[model samples]
Structure formats: C-alpha cells, structure tokens
Target: MITRTVVMRAVRTVVFTLALPCLLVAVWWVASDSSTSVYAPPLRTILSRFDDVWTADRIRGDVVPSLLRLAAGYASAAVAGVVLGVGIGLSRTARAVCEPALEFLRAVPPPVLVPVIMLFAGIGDTMKIAVIASGCVWPVLLNTVAGVRAVDPVATETARAYGVRGAAWLRSLVLPSASPQIFTGLRQALSIGVILMVISEMFAASNGLGYAVVQFQRGFAIPEMWTGILVLGLLGVVLALLFTLVERRALAWYHRSRGARRKAGSGGA
Candidate 1:
C-alpha cells in the first residue's frame, strides 16, 4: 500500500524529471517553427522524418551493429580492467611495474589510435570494438584500483587475524569493499564506450549510427542528420537510465548500510 507522502513524492519526481525536457521541446518548437535555416530544420519536420530515416532496415543495418560493438567492447573492458586492477591494487610491486606503461597508454586518446588500429586490425568490426575497449578500460581499471586500495586497513587486518585466507577472503571481503569504485569505473567506461563506438564508426565504417549520421550530413539531409543526432542523445539517456537501475540493484546493500549509518548519526546528533 502507498502512503500519501509516497504518492506525493512520486508525483513530484515525475514532474521534475519531465519538466525540463518538455520545456525544451516547447521552446525548440516555437523557435524553429518559422526558421528557414538549411542546417537547422524545424522540430516538427525532424520528428516527422525520424520515422522515414530510422526505419526497420536502418535499425537492423546501423543500430544493431553499433550496439553489438559497444557491448563486446564494454564487456571485454570490464573483465580485463577488474582483473588487472585487482592485481595492481593488491600488489605494490605490480602497481609499480605497470603504472608507467598504463599511464602512457591511457594518455593517448582512443580516437587517435583508430588509425593505428586500422593499420593492424583493418577497417573491420574488430578494429571498432578494439577502439571502444581501449577508451573504456582506463576508467574501470583506475576506479577498481582506487576502490581496492581504499578498503579499510583495519578490516583487512581483522580478516587476516580471523584466518580468512586466500580467494575466499578476497571474494568475501575485498571485492565487496571495492565493488562501489568498480561500478563507478564501469559507469565511466560505459559513456566512453558509447563515444568510442561512434568515433570508431565515423573513422572507417560502412555502417553503424555514426556512419549514417556522417553520410546524412555529407548528403545535405539536414532533417535526417538532426534525427540521427537526436537518436544518439536518446540512446545515451536510455543507456544511462538502464545502468542506474542495474547499479541500484547491485549496490543495494551498500546503499542500505550508508542509510543506516546516516540514521545513526542523525539520532546521535
């Protein structure tokens, strides 16, 4: 059963969440209604053309391939980053040995590496996925290391004292402590992956959303181009929302613990 307060809060959230977007759409509609710019099409025209351009064929050819590359790259980065991050975080020697190389690689922007990747992997899906993975890996790696290192020393000592040894100890204690930071990295990586996916397709792709947008712009299909841009924005928002839901579910315990701590502090005060 929902209380009045809960209902009110839900209503308020819905209003605040939707208010800005609706306002912006209203403004855009009003502002562009009478405009005659070739580059900036009217909002209504763009909306109408969205269905024509982003049809089933386009979705199968462009959107599906783009999503596949993003998923493959992001998953690979998450696994590799966590593994390497764990090693570096847990071992001072590993951290010292790898820090310089990792720093150098991370400093090189992923977009710049597209040419170099193409030289080796050619202009295939593999190259695109590699570029996305390269861009996404650093955030997760750095965040995981930071999270692991930030785990309470006292907790580690206590675990050691209690004979919580080996992989069991790491799985039970270390991973949970570091999960928050790891998730932070994953979130950062997700955005990077999306950016790289587009950039990769822009550089040397025959298909994908980015390629379509580029093609549309080159062909002077202003409304279609705008539609592509709008779709990309919507995709980012949708992916972010999905990730947030997953994060909340995965970190429910951490959230509850923090809430409990806050309540205790307030009570004491």
Candidate 2:
C-alpha cells in the first residue's frame, strides 16, 4: 500500500507547506537581530520569552478559557446554522419571509453589536460566546441554504420516488449532496470564530489570551505581547489543521466521486 513515490510526495507537500512560513521567520530573525527599539524587540528575545511568558499556569488561566469559548460558540453556531438552513432551504415561503431579516442582521458587523449583546448577555463567558456565535453563524447558515438549494434535482426526484420522504430523503440525499458547500461554510466560520473570540475577550475579560495580550501592551511588555500574538496564531493553525482532518474524513466520499467524474470526463475528451 505504501510506496517510495507516495513518501516522496508527502515529503514534498510538507516542504512546500512550510517553505513560506520558514522563509518569513528567517527574514524576521535576521531583520530583528540588531533591533534596539523597546516596541519592536529582536525575534530572538521574543522566542526566548515565549516559554517563560506562556508557562503552564498562564496557559491554564488564559488559553484554555479562550479555546473553551471558541469551541462552545462554534459548535452552537454550526448546529443552529444547519438546522435553520435546511428548514429554510426546503421552503419557498419561509425563505422569502426570512430573507430580509437575515440580510439586515448579517449586514451589521458582529463587533459593533458587542456592546448591545453585552447589555443583554452581560460581561461574562456568555457574552463572548454569543459574540463568536453571532459572527460565525452567518457564513454557515448562508452556505447551507445555498448548498441545499443546489442539490441535484434528479437525485431529489429519485429519492422521492423511492419513498425516501421527509427525514429519510434529507439524510440520504440532500445532506450528502450539500455537505461540500456546508464544509466550505464551516471553514469560513472557523476563521471568523477565532477572530470574534479574540475581539470578545479584549473587552471585559480578566483571563484570556486577548486580555493577556492587551494587558501586556498596556504594561509595555512588548516581548510578552508578541508572544501572546504568536500563541494565538499557533492556536489558529492548530484549529485549522483539526478542522481539515475532520473535513477530509467526512467528505472522503464526495472527494472520491468528484475525482471519478473528472477522470471520466478527461477520458471522454
């Protein structure tokens, strides 16, 4: 099952993926080595402080809370988006009624609504979670609606003919057909969720990555602030990798089907 060619390809993929980031880090290392500015410390200084600043205690008090909120908000948004999306996608009357309200709400930026949400949800984990969910839900909801609408008409008819009505029809045909688009929405929502997580935490929070970063900045701890930012970036990359793993597993069939179709088309040509 495994071959030298496969191993080589995997190595090449890893190299290409890392090349730009590695290059950028190298450039920064060289550029910042001679820096004497208090605001912009050397990359070496930042790296040296990284371990000390982001110790286990700091991680537990800051990073864990942020991640927990992100997970909770993102999960809730995904669930709500899919459910409402499917319902609205299947009904012309519901779509028409909801379209205007959806448009109006989505147009308002999530950050601007933070104070309003704070008024209702208060200055706690609830507010932060709500903020993240508010921003993340739009992309997932809109994409799901579009994906459901784009399901193959022939497949829908076949399902109906086979007495696969209601939930059976949706489970067997609609959901699978729309999954690719739904995953696209999910990818977009993930980035938004991360951003909103930080933004929400920057306000009225004592123990979170964003709050820590802000405090470091205010206290003129530039190196520690930079480390905080670096940690956030690393966290985002880790979350993205996790999401990719899930997507690949979930969409393996869809990917295989597309590959088959492409091969068939090429052969015909």
Candidate 3:
C-alpha cells in the first residue's frame, strides 16, 4: 500500500507546502538579527519567548476560550446558512422576499456591527460569538444558495422519475450536488470567523488570544505580542488543514465522478 512512489509524492507535497513559509522565516531571521527597534524585535527574540510566554497556563486562560468561541460561532453559522440557503434556493418567492434584506445585511461590514451587537448582547462571550457568526454566515448562505440553484435539472428529473421525493429526494440528490459550493462557502467563512473572533475579543474581553495580544501591546511586550500573532497564524493553518481533510472525505464521491467524466472526455478526444 505504501509504495515508494506514494512516499515520494507525499514528501514532494510537504516540501511544496512548506517551502514559502520556511523561506519567509529564514529571511525574517536574517533580516532582524541585528534590529534595535522597539517595535520590531528580532525574530530570534520572538521565537525565544515562545517557551515562557505561551505556557500551559496562558493557553488554558486565553487560546482555549478563543477557539471555543470560534467553534461555536462557526457551527452556528454553518447550520443557519445551509438551512436558510436551502429554503431560499428552493422557493422563488422566498428568494424575492429575502433578497433585499440579505443584500443590506451583507453589505454592512461585520466589524461595524460589533458595537451595535455589544449594545444589545453586552460584552460577554455571546457578543463575540454573535460577531463571528454575523461575518461567517454570509459566505456560507450565499454559496449554498448558488450551489442549490446550480443543481443539474437532468439529475433532478432523473431522481424524481425514480420516485425520489421530499426529504428522500433532497438527501439523495440535492445535498450531494450542492456540497462542493457549500464547502467553498465554509472555507471562506472559516477565515472570516478567525478575523471576527480577534476583532470581538479585542473589545471588552478579559481572556482570549486577541485580548492577550492587546494587553501585550499596551504593556510594551513586543515579543509576546508577536508570539500571539504567530500563534494565531499557526491556528489558522491547522484549522485549514483540518477543513481540507473533512472536505476531501465528504466530497470523495464528487471527486470520483469528476475524474470519471474527465477520463471519458479525454478518451473521446
């Protein structure tokens, strides 16, 4: 199963993925080796502080809370987006009724809503979660709507002719057809969720990665602030990889179908 070709391909993939990041790190290390600026600390100095700055206690107090909020918000957004998107996609009347409101809301930036949300939801985890959800929902909702609308009419007719109806039809046909677009929305929402999490935390928060970063900046802890940013970047990369794994698993059938189609086309050509 684990052939030399597979191993070599895996190694090549890893190298390609990491090449840019490794180069950037090397450049930063060399460039900042003798920096004396208060704002821009040496990369070595920043790396050195990782052990002391991001200890178990700090991670427990800050990073975990931020991640939990991000998860909650992202999940809530995904569910709401897909359900509402499906409904709107299915009914022309529903789409017409909701279009204006959707456009208005989407046009308004999520960050601007933070203060307004804080006014109603207060400066609790609720507000932060809401902020993240507000930003994350738009991408998924819009993408799901597009995906659903784009479902092949031929496939729909085929499914209906086979006595597939109602929820059975939806499960057997609609979801699978729309899943690729829905996944696209989800991928976009993830980055927005990360951004909103930090923005929300930066305002009236006691314990969160963003809050910790702000505290470090105010206290003139440059290295610690840099470390917090570094942690956030690492967190995004990890989340993205996890999402890719899930997407690949979920869309395995779609991928296979596309591959078959391509092969058929090539053979015909």
Assess each prediction's global lDDT (C-alpha) against the native.
0.95, 0.95, 0.97
- Listed in order, each prediction's TM-score against the native is 0.97, 0.98, 0.97
In TM-score terms, candidate 3 sits at 0.97
Clashing pairs in 3: none
122-165 in candidate 3: lDDT tens per residue? 99999999999999999999999999999999999998899999
Q: Which digits, one per residue and each the tens of the lDDT, describe model 2 over residues 76-172?
A: 9999999999989888899999999999999999999999999999999999999999999999999999999998999888888888998888898
Q: Which candidate number has the best lDDT?
A: 3
Per-residue lDDT over 1-269 for candidate 1, one digit per residue giving the tens place of the 0 to 100 score: 98999999999999999999999999999999998999887899999998899999999999999999999999999999999998899999998999999999999999999999999999999999999999999999999999889989999999999999899888989899999999999999999998999999998689999999999999999899999999998999999999999999999999999999999999999
- Top TM-score prediction, candidate number: 2
TM-score head-to-head 1 vs 2, winner: 2
lDDT of 3 at 78: 100
Better-scoring candidate (TM-score), 2 or 3: 2
The 10 consecutive residues of candidate 1 with the worst lDDT sum are 165-174
Q: How accurate locally is residue 150 in candidate 3, as Cα lDDT from 0 to 100?
A: 96
- What would you estimate as the lDDT of candidate 3? 0.97
RMSD (CA, Å), each prediction: 1.2, 0.9, 1.1
Count of backbone clashes, every candidate in sequence: 0, 0, 0
